[model samples]
Target: MANKTLVPQAKAGLNKFKMEAAKEVGVNLTDGYNGDLTSRQNGSVGGQMVKKMVEQYENNL
Candidate 1:
C-alpha cells in the first residue's frame, strides 16, 4: 500500500490564522510549494497561528 499526502489549496477564503502563525514563527509561506514542509513544521506554524488569533479574540471580548 502507498500513503497519500494532502496538499493545501487556496479556496474562496484565506486561512488567515495559518498565515499569521507562519509569520510569527518566521516561516516563509509565500509560494505554492508548501507541500515540501513536513507535517510537523506545517502543524507548528498553523497551531501557533491559531493560538495567537484565539488569544487576541479573547482579549477583545
Candidate 2:
C-alpha cells in the first residue's frame, strides 16, 4: 500500500500526533518498522488516534 499524503509537509506532524496517541495508550511504539507489535496493540493505537482527532474536531466546533 502506498502511504501517500496530500500535504507532504504534514507527514511529520501526523507522525508526531501518532506517537503522542501511542504514548497515551501506553503503547511502546517506536519509530520505523513496528512489525514486532501485535495486531491488537497496533489497532489500539490507531483507534486512540481517531478518537483523539474526533474529540479535537468536536471541541473546535
Candidate 3:
C-alpha cells in the first residue's frame, strides 16, 4: 500500500484569522481537507466576518 499524506491545497489562500472565522461560521476547514469550497466563497466568508467585526468594534469606540 502506498502512503498518502494529506496537505492543504492552498497554503496562501487563507490566513489564520480567516480560518478561525470560517470555523466560527461553521465551515469545515481542516488542515488537509477543505472539502469543496471555492476560493471566492472562502474569501468572502472570511472577509465579511472581518468587516462585521471591525464595524462592531468601531461602534463601541
lDDT of 1 by residue, 1-61 (tens): 6643244464313456566678888777764678777788787897896787689899999
- CA lDDT, every prediction? 0.71, 0.94, 0.70
Cα lDDT tens digits for candidate 2, 1-55:
7979989999999999999999999899999889999999999999999999899
Question: Model 3: per-residue lDDT, tens digit, 1-61?
Answer: 7643355664454456567777776676766767588887687777767786899899999
Tell me each candidate's RMSD, in Å, in order. 5.9, 1.0, 9.9
Best by lDDT: 2
Which order, best to worst by lDDT? 2, 1, 3
Give the range where candidate 2 is weakest over 10 consecutive residues by summed lDDT.
1-10
| Consecutive 10-residue window with the lowest summed lDDT within model 1 | 4-13
Off by more than 4 A, model 1: 1-17
How well does candidate 2 match the true structure in TM-score terms? 0.91
Query: What are the models' TM-scores?
Result: 0.58, 0.91, 0.45
Q: How well does candidate 2 score on lDDT at residue 56?
A: 93
Which scores greater on lDDT, model 1 or model 3?
A: 1
Better of 1 and 2 by TM-score: 2
In TM-score terms, which candidate is top?
A: 2
